[model samples]
Target: MKGSYSLLDIDSSTGDVYLAKGASIGICLGAVKVPRVNPDTRNVTYAGTMSGCSNCFSSDGTGTLYNLSATAVSTKIRPTSVLGSLDVATGEPRDSVAVRRGPSAGMVVDGKNRFAVAAFTAPEGTSYIGSGTAFVPDNNATGQMVIIDLTTGDVVRTMSGFRVGGHGGSLVHGGLMNSVQLDPSTRTGWTYGPYHEQIHQFSY
Candidate 1:
């Protein structure tokens, strides 16, 4: 309750929701019970703090909570592009995997919980707020798409050098990479940056 809530996901298995908070300062995870009589007024229970977390997801089948940590705020304060796994039922951390890139933005897990895809935006300060737009292109920083093996928490593959962070007339507010969604049936994924004009698509 002390920080701003940024992202949220629901676990289909137990109907529990997980939340990520604090974008600029330290990050924390929270949860709330479902089937509430009033959705807007329901109370949220604090889980615990996860340093540098930008987003989180709950697997429908396995009830596993995945958290994304980005940025290099400090060596002891935050981690640069790290993925953390937590037990949904107990809120206990299971694993922490380091990503090759930094400042990761979004992530999505497959329906079967076999794999996940994460998006990385351009380096920090690559974009700045503009007069009429949410963001203005600055440095020619690009983005990356990374695929990971969920069970093993290993990087399967990485696609880099894509336009991001207000590059090539593409503008995004706050950060370049925003969110990632996956379609298990089609084996396709879509990455979105709110201020950008195009949607990034990839297949695996």
Candidate 2:
């Protein structure tokens, strides 16, 4: 509770709450296992953490936690971006793969863990340094949606030329691209931005 908390996701199967903590590394950056049983009290136990993980999703069947690393803070710059997988029970990293887009925002993993979709906020004329806290997006910046294969970690498809902007919080917290949801049964997904009219839909 001490660190700055941003994005949040829940594993419906286990009732675990996954939280993204800004400026925190290691175990403190992931989920807090069912910290509360009733309304007044909280437990707040650590689930796990991955370097630069700003957004996370948990698979219902396997309980594997998938996170997106959008920036490289140690190198003092934003890199291409990466997606990492972790075993929720043991709190260990299972797999990691590079993402094709840079400065990504929201992400969602399919129910079967077959694929993941991410929303990207293209930083057209801005320069990002040290986790993108100073990034400033220009008018030329456009939105992109990418589908990544979970098994091979490959970008299967990309959709671009949409309205996108990184204007909410600091880029390190995923800017304005902070909302993504997927319906595994229909293979449909939705992404949202700060503007109410900017909601987008996709199908796989």
Candidate 3:
């Protein structure tokens, strides 16, 4: 495997960082797809992302990141259906062309196994620009959150017109859909993005 793998394998008996370079440069966190092999037919299978970072955000009085630079965010990826065949002879991510480029932040999954990715849409701002300093906003005041559909290999949606650090209280960067939560009892979903500390509530 010439390319690098981001996931790591941990030993139960030992507290060690077994995998090398599991973290993406410039604060990459969120979801990823892992490949597995079945011994019986030598078939390949996929597992969802294990763990990742959440673009840290400052919370309002309610612990929600709303239209703020410090808003927490992340990316998520999961298989909707088997896009690749189980045949190990030819199944090594061959049927997919989904390559994400940006600072990955948070991820969330729904009942249908669909994944929502949240991140700062500044590939040139965070990852490529500095070591760990402040993110030099993309065009200074223009930012957005890109949502990709892993099942269809396309970007399904995007929440644009988000301002980074415009709220005058700490660098209000990007919305890190990191605090998405669903209440099964009420069948309600809550998604908080970057802004002046407001929670966007939705229902099913």
Candidate 4:
């Protein structure tokens, strides 16, 4: 509420709001946790921070929070996944740590399947530093989707499609600007195609 924020998510299970500090185009600063009910009348607290700028934040039906992070790299930057929870009552550090890592950005939580689906649309190679904010992807590379286990933070599968710009094309195309849709019942998900006019879908 006091500082600048670029992205935010309400924990579906807890009602707590998370604000990610960032900009239209820049490196990651950090994040804050605002509890639904302020125990002891506290305003807010820093739940977590990382070296890589967080790309997205999502919470599952069960209140499990997830985020995609990109660290600056000379070669292609491999994104990370932060999975955990913040205490709903007082916003205690149940520890929303960076559990696992993958490629690209965009994500959705399938609580029923206990999985997080991410968009691996980063160009064949892109840096996470300046690119993290500008989100300028290679534009020539195809897009990909990744399925990660919520409990173990393990990437279970990956699906790909051509001409998808999520690799960073536009910060909005894949990172904070776009999204991934999931149908847990059918184990299906969707992503963006920055190079063309098409919505890519994947089944796993």
Highest lDDT among the candidates is held by which one?
Answer: 2
Between candidates 1 and 2, the one scoring higher on TM-score is 2
RMSD of 1: 7.5
Candidate 4, 90-160: lDDT as tens digits: 43445444534443456677888888776654433433553422244555545666677877767687665
Q: Rank the candidates by TM-score, best first.
A: 2, 1, 4, 3
Q: What is the total number of backbone clashes in candidate 4?
A: 10
Per-candidate local distance difference test:
0.55, 0.59, 0.33, 0.54
TM-score each candidate. 0.66, 0.71, 0.36, 0.64
Query: Candidate 2, after superposition: displacement of residue 56 in Å?
Result: 5.2
Minimum summed lDDT over a 10-residue window in model 4 is located at 21-30
Q: Who is ahead in TM-score, 1 or 4?
A: 1
Residues 41-153 of candidate 3: C-alpha lDDT, one tens digit per residue: 65544432222322222112111111111212332211111111112224232343332443334333332334333434343343423223334554544444445454564
The candidate scoring highest on TM-score is 2
Worst 10 residues of 1 by lDDT: 166-175
lDDT of 4: 0.54
**Residue 13 CA displacement from its true place in model 2, Å:** 1.4
The collision pairs in model 2 are 35-43
- Where does the lowest 10-residue lDDT sum fall in candidate 2? 31-40
Query: Residue 154 in model 2: shift from native, Å?
Result: 1.2
By lDDT: ranked, best first: 2, 1, 4, 3
Error of 3 at 32 (Å): 12
lDDT of 2 by residue, 47-160 (tens): 666554554443444567677765543535445567877676887777788885355666777857488887776633345554433354465556777888888888898877
